[model samples]
Target: MELYKAAMVLGGVGDALGYRNSRWERCPSGVAILSELKALGGLEGITVSADEWPVSDNTVMHIVTAETLVSDIWSLTDLYREMVKAYVEIVEQIHKRQPDPATIEGCSQLKPDNYLLGWHTPFNKKGSGFGAATKAMCVGMRYWQPEKLDNLVEVSIECGRMTHNHPTGFLGSLCTALFASYAVQRKPVVEWGREMLKVLNAAETYCRKTIRHMAEYQESWFYFETKWQSYLEERGIAQEGQNTPKFPKIYNAEERDQVYREWSSEGVGGRRGHDAPMIAYDALLSVDNNWTELCNHAMFHGGLGGATGSIAGCLYGLLFGMVDVPKGLYLNLEFREKLEELAAKLHKAANEGEAV
Candidate 1:
């Protein structure tokens, strides 16, 4: 299978698996409503049940991103506008279903406070939510110009700002995109981390320069930089005096559970923008290109396991292609065919330099 198809299908599969396993506990109403949509044949023939899993907002946004890119909107500004339009359409469709309040609350945070009446708007707050980051893989993989890494970072940030407008959110999106770009090139996983740090350092400079002109974002940018630095330090990706830690070794189920507990101990597990990618990164590093183990580790994180799993799955799909992903995961996944078709469209667009 093509890299794009592998990434999209595996990512959605991971999202569905994680959503089915983790989200119901805290958002029972949301889960039930989504399940109902599946049963009613309202979600594109996607179904959710005790034996089947359906995709969530993560996959929804991801598909939107892919769709926008393939829509032939080449310029950054046009691309951004198209993405916003696509996102609103998806959100409105869900809203028509009258999702539970808690679910609406989750969706509402994606829109700006001054959102137009009857229209779901992008969040204006400097949120560090993982939603944007989880859906960014396709954007990264869609455009591959090493010389335009800076541009890629900027575009990725813009895609993220459609919902999550915080620097941490942007960073998470940036990291995922950069990793995907590198993965498609068949770079070593360590190279992915090293390239990430290089791009991140440059991105910080870009943020510092850009934020100066956009004073309103200064505070959030400052917070993001400080927190991101500390996050890197904690992961041993950055240190005052020592070599960066090597990619983590693969963990057994017990070890994976322990890592989850440790992360939760800090009151920062599952859903935080930084935490999800961080967990995914750790899982990626721990494995020796073992897609199953990476997904297992990510899924074990609880609550937002789907987001983490999607991130890990994207990287795995990019690196190893679709064959490596477990066949069982696709058995009852929602929109499997659509996801594959969209992925093929994206890959073709990128290769042909034409609108999808």
Candidate 2:
């Protein structure tokens, strides 16, 4: 398995398993979820069939972004138009998949004429959900070059703000994309959070100078930075093996939820934009190259399982490729072929430069 293909495929796999027809995602207890997985034969015994373990809107919207990026839209204006059109089209499938409310609201307000007029969706203060982050992987894949850091930051903000106009909302998109780029570069997992903070400074510069109504969200713009800093601080404490607590081995439903919420700066685990990416980052850092532990840390945490799982799975897959992954995870995954195809195209685009 190629690196890019593994990344995208595992992303879908994570979304599927974490979702499990919304059974595991909605289940508040990690212990209970693990028990259920045991009954169903665990990761090796379970197949990621669409009928049983179908992916939610997390993977669906991700593919939408990947498809639009690969299309023959070279310029930013044209790219935004194509992306908006593709996002609008996904509304047809929203009923089948449980979508984020921010996604639905933002996509509903998009119009073809708006993109043509050099405008995106209106400012959405309440749009600080993880929906935009879910589809940001390909943006990183497309511009995953050191020289293209400016392009990556700019384009990520544009795509993120297309729907989530608030800084907190769109910055989650930026973090997801930026981390994917870092993964492709094979940067150390421990360095990712710190590196992301440095990149956040760059992102803040861009937002302050470029966004038309930056002042509206300026107050909350640092929300993301604060959250990342907190995560890094906690990580540092854990690395030192100090009195800082480690992730608990067992918990009831409410206890599990409370622990994760406490882990989140946003007080909601992976439910919001700030916490989802952070949770995924934490998952990537916690696992010592163990795929199943990766699954446990990323998904079964009584949060937005699909979103965090996809983000973490994609990063882990990109970093390690498919050598260590269980075969059953991808053997029956939905749209496996299509994911590989897109991965190849995205890899080519990232390496050889985007199509002109």
Candidate 3:
């Protein structure tokens, strides 16, 4: 129960800190971000409050997903319906959250019953953003039963496709949820990404069977799978800690851009679905037991700091809970109490085999 609370609450804390009222989120330079942190007395001096460090759209959409999951939904249709309704409400608050373009477009095209008819937002090359994955931690929490891996993939991919139809987009959704489920099962963090690749085979088969008619579906999965495999290889090499190259504690803008470019769709770094989660995973794996350093690497990168920090925080919180999180990091976080309530409910629902 406490672990769930940590995941949700720290996710907000990460968003707030990395967002820094949206000042650092788009800065694209880890060096500059570190310098600014030093000026503010570094991480310890920070407080996560709305007026100071408000959670970004990442946490906002995550809340929407969490609320929908805890509703009394009897079937997938009901789940998707509730999601559409919630998204419609969120769209009205655009002036506040600054949602991604794909989200806005997808919500605009949604019909209350469209999902029931097996319809989703059409594929757009540019629609493969990280928004889908960033908001899916609850999807992982909701269907966390390890034996329900297929169910997790089905719902997660469909949820991703509601706004982002590309393989990178939906696959990232599956990856995030899968990792959360593994965390609930107490799986080793080092093996999570590789395990995800094994599951990707099943997910790819499912996608091929369901969306074969879509253009280039096979190529899409191939691209997504290859990228993940490559990342896993890099992680494995790093784990050996032999005479191989090492990643820096804080990357300069150029080095950060290069790393993200390799993972990006075009060159947008953390905005892409795949790279966003990859960045979070990289941050988690690079650290031994340094939570602050993990967060520093997670948030100071040249990518979408809020998205990566939120993902990293969710992963860490799930595995370690709030016990090891810095004291007072979330004391002033906006909606902290509400997030903890939702997390408790979500955790209870997961254990009870029904939404409560």
Candidate 4:
């Protein structure tokens, strides 16, 4: 119960804060659609007024994923169909409104007109955006058991493909989900970090082996492998045949600040799928269970603040549960009650070993 509540609430808080920070010039399509959905009571009676801190597509999709799992709609195909239905409804609402150019551009990629044809028919976006990782908390929370980790990874990939079909996008989503699942299961931070590297290596190896037979995934596979290798090199962990290098545990304030400085300059807060998870992982390692500090450091990264913050928040919330999350963080969250309600439903589902 505590795990479910903490993941939902903390992740939402992070999303709200991140959305608030990023809504300066342009609003994301998910945010715009979710806003309209809220106004029309399409979001389970949850509404965010104009004055409230608006959530991004991250929270919107996170809620959808959570609701789907808690409802026991376990089949991947069925889950994808239901998610597409929800996404199409939001896209329709988005079209009704006078959204900004960025929102329109994002909506164009969703291919709402072709949605009814089949789940695989939509035009897949090639960009490795952070959308997949942002909504992966639910997968981790729902399948936190060690024995369930394989299923968790498979489901995470399926959910990622629903919007972000590329390997880079889905792999980032897998890492985030696996991180959250590991954290929820009380795995040590260092162990999880090493495990994440292994997962990435395995993914890269699989992609390499299958690239000849499956040419479609080549571009994304190459992109992820190259970028991830560069990232590992920058962090001084790249070595010949070193699949799982030991990630340094940032224990001091000075070390944490140095990492933040380095990543901030490297565009850690941008829209890339790879940067946010690494930033989140760094924040988690640096802060040592201080959720507030972790979020603050994550938010300091500007553009990707909310996502980085949300990832860190989800992990921290999972590690410590709700009892330890500072109450002050909850005071001004606009959709706290709605998130709490959803979390309760998820908790009930988990407790009963089936969705009610």
Q: What TM-score would each prediction reach against the true structure?
A: 0.76, 0.92, 0.91, 0.73
Query: How far out, in Å, is residue 44 in model 2?
Result: 1.1
| Alpha-carbon deviation at 325 in model 1, angstroms | 3.1
Better of 1 and 3 by lDDT: 3
lDDT for each residue of candidate 2 in 265-285, tens digit (9 for 90 to 100): 556578777888887887777
Q: What tens digits encode model 3's per-residue C-alpha lDDT throughout 1-356?
A: 98899999988888787778878876877778888889987778776678988888888888888898888888877888888888877876754655667777767766775555433566766567888888888888888887777778888887787777778778888888988888888876677777788888788777777754356555566777777778777655423332232565656555766787678777656787788888888777777446787777777766688888888888888888875565667988888988999999888888886532
Please tell me which model should have the higher lDDT, number 1 or number 2. 2
Between prediction 2 and prediction 3, which has the larger lDDT? 2
Higher-ranked by TM-score: 1 or 3 = 3
Best candidate (score: lDDT):
2
Model 2 stretches with alpha carbons more than 4 Å out: 237-257, 265-267, 354-356
Off by over 4 Å in 4: 21-52, 92-117, 121-125, 200-213, 225-268, 322-328, 348-356
**Top-down lDDT ranking:** 2, 3, 1, 4
- lDDT of model 1 at residue 47? 42
Minimum summed lDDT over a 10-residue window in model 1 is located at 96-105
lDDT for position 137 in model 3? 81
Local distance difference test scores for all models: 0.62, 0.80, 0.77, 0.60
> lDDT for model 4, on a 0 to 1 scale?
0.60
